[model samples]
Target: MDHQIQRGTVVLATPWGVAAIFSGVGSQYAGMATRLHQRYAIVRETFTEASDVLGFDVAELCTEPSARERLNLQTESQLALLTTSVAMHRAFERQTAGPAVTHAAGHSLGEYSALCVAGALPFAAALRLVRHRGEAIADVAARLDGGMMWVIGLDTGTVEHLCRLWTEQDVHPVHLSIVDAPRRAAVSGRTADLHSAAGEFEARGAQVFPLRVTGPFHSPLMGPAADQLADFLTGIDLAPPRLPVISGVDARPHPGGPAGARLLADQLVSPVRWHAVQQRLAAEGVGASLEMGPGRVLTFLSAGTRGHPRPWPVDRYEDFDALARAMRLGADDEPAVLDACLRIAVSTPTRRQDTDVAGHYRRLEETRRARKPGAVATGLGALDALLAAKGISARERRGHLAAATGGRTWQ
Candidate 1:
């Protein structure tokens, strides 16, 4: 089937909902997301929110020449990529008025972005978590001598066998880190060991290419970083996702709360099962895949998958319109009505220290009992009225709404 977009429409597409795929590190570049930032108010607001948490101008870092080089560093790169990916997703939602994401996934560091999109983590909390994660990984990389390489034209089984042989014989550790496609994988180990093994992979009819990364991520060598991240995550709160988020670590839906925290922390030392992630998406009945970040790396990976759910990259301004038309998303649709429980939840403050906690809960329960399970109003306009009547300030409205509604305001 033809996967390419022709005249802003996708051909041979399925009827199931879309899967949003967030880009990870190594996808960031100078001036990435500048177009979205310049054109969309939501994008600018996202960057501003990230800056408040990160204590740096993320927009400037992505666009400025001098600051762009900092993206090469793990800490800066991770934060920048997370901010940009989140911003792009928000912009896509507002601009396209598309169907709510049915599922979400990310590659490596992009998992944090996927969690944010799925409403498992608050935006500010995600930024702070990524900052600490980047720092922890950077610290580990500084202490260890490691690298990663891509091995194409070889199945994962063959690559795993080769890695096992090398690890059994060599002093340095070598492990399979990521399986991107059926026959494409990445291996990680000491820098010298990677270079030494490159010849063997090439000799076996596989093309070996070095990746631009600081450390051998997604391997046991990153145990210290995983520990550091686990400690940091314990203090943060995680909520259940509105939509399913496939984990790169295990290619399974994240079990939210403490279990999710453990999975995320352990992911640092776990191989990214991206091939399985794609399979999971297909099994979930995702009709199409949208890359909501700077580069088309995830798009390319999805394209390589056999059958169903064609991939599209929605990084540029025009991409949103193209994909919206192709998928016929939100076309001629009436405004979505909010449920009573969700309206009350949005109006309620998440902070435990808020005044009249018992009163809020009692009112929420009363509203839930009084109203049926669906359709509180013609649209979110009713929710806006409720928020205003409840005296929820404009500044807190977006965060409350996003948290309560899983960032899909249209839903």
Candidate 2:
């Protein structure tokens, strides 16, 4: 399936459902959420709430260039990404009535964002949890001189073999941390060990680049951090997700509550199976995937992969309209007119005396029952007339209609 936005509209070659993918660490920028914070009250409110929980101003950390160094720190970056991603999701829900994603997943620290979006964790609680997680990992990194590196142009088997070989020969342990693509993977270990193995990796026709991370995450060396995180998680309340969230630890739907908590803690010391996660989403028939935060990292990873879902980045203010349209159109195989009517009804504010919600739904059902060729057009026209009668402006109606029809204008 291919999703394209042309002339303020979304065009879909094949209608498939959307999967929401959250951004992880290293995706943060200095002003990633500045526009969002300025435009939406919900976004500002989210930041304020996060500040209350985090003891620092999240908005300032994300927007000021002076805070660049601080934002790059593991704890600060994780908190900023989580807060910004959740704010974006909240704003999206407000604009589109609700998210239209069939499933949700996150990379590395992003799993917390996915769980929050799935309603498994409250926003305040999520903030506190990630803080402790970041602090624990940072403490581990402070004591151990370790780091991670990305290796390209090498298959997974060869990379695994090389890691095993280096660990045995050099007495320095290095492990394959992430398998992002077929020939792209990341390794985690002590800084000296990674530097020592770089020549060997290059000798085997692989390109190596060190990652800007504080610690060698997703390796056995992180076992202490994982243990600390596990203890912290036991005190927090976790609810079952309203939507399925694929875990990076195993690329399977997370079983919420205690089991889900275990997977999250273990994730610190376990390799991220992103390749398997993508495959699982493809197998589930996801048509489009939306990156819900600032960077294009996940978008780039999903690109050019056969049988993978088409990836789109909702990283800017202008991306909301097209994203809403694409999600609305791809939500199901229902008639376009029905979607338009339903969206219009949901987006409109209700009066204090308006208590005929059931009647409104009955009317929607009646419209759905009319399946004739011209009936759809007639129903759409009637809906327009009703909106106009209720004092809806021409511009607002056009926007609503475009959202409903994936940017197609009615004649």
Candidate 3:
């Protein structure tokens, strides 16, 4: 399929009961979507097109270590994440067979990818839009001394009360950036206010960790970015989304076009109701959801949300197997549908809440690479290649294979 074709996500529904989810910025890592780029012509062309629009090589940016690290910065992460997600979605569409996605949702930056999937925004336009937003956000961060902190072990009510308390105490503009799960939230503000709030929460037996970010994203502190973003969007005319896309601002499905633009713009400074979005999708009977891009964050979040829709992650090109399984299971087959339902009903499908995700996973990935090497050396694990090339023995050599399995490491 050409990039010029009228696309997916136009309020469209797949015969299968599924939702397409997108991963956000924090999910960025080196070598993201590399497998897709190497195996699928569409994925490679997607990055090539994005590279042209961004005036740099997006595919190389994802593959290169230093560039990928730069992508973690607010200015770069959003674009990289969006490009990878859109590329993956586009490639999936061209596949011979797969499950249909009835709904789509994205976390913060991921929403742009969802819109692209919805066909509301062209891929190039989406890339340009995210780049502009990132630049605006980076500009705001450059001028303002701000940061974000994750407050754990605290209820939404308590977090809200704390925000109110800080405001009352003259902390200026401290605000909740995201309600990640039931008791987990990310608060954004000036450095002092963020630390102040963290200290307060910690004193009350809550755990707080500073997010690896340069800006106070999703808070009133982003007003300047919002302004710049609105001006940047002045010339763009977004088409109506063919598929239903959820808005992080209010956790509601947006009906594309001007309304979608408004919702995206508002999300710049509004708290991302990610947990609520998960709940809404679950309530809508989205049997299973797939995180389209690298990182299992959304998959893990599924375990924390209100209902277990059985999130299958698609962090790598190999992760498409899970996507295929989702489509096949929900293929209107009574037995397969019942099997999935029973699996979800019987399993909690999540980890303990207090895991040191950032540190632990980084180390875990490093160790796995050291021990296993080959495709596992990169986050995209190609077991077939590993088997094809000397079967994971002392030395290694290989060619890229076609598969869609997603895991921080090989599943």
Best by lDDT: 2
Please say which candidate is ahead in lDDT: 1 or 3.
Answer: 1
Could you say which candidate leads in TM-score?
2
Q: Kindly report which residue stretches of model 1 are placed more than 4 angstroms away from their true locations once superposed.
A: 1-14, 26-32, 169-172, 316-319, 329-411
**lDDT score at residue 373, model 1, on the 0-100 scale:** 27
Tell me how far the alpha carbon of residue 166 in candidate 3 is from the true structure, in angstroms, after superposition. 2.5
Alpha-carbon error at 102 in model 3, in Å?
1.1
Task: Work out the TM-score per prediction.
Answer: 0.74, 0.75, 0.74
TM-score of candidate 2 against the unseen true structure = 0.75
Better of 1 and 2 by lDDT: 2
Per-residue lDDT for 117-220 in model 1, tens only?
Answer: 99999999998999899888989998988889999998889998889888888744589999988889999999988888888888899999889887999998
Winner by TM-score between candidate 3 and candidate 2: 2
Candidate 1: residue 37 lDDT (0-100): 74
lDDT of each: 0.73, 0.77, 0.67
**Poorest 10 consecutive residues of model 3 by lDDT?**
399-408
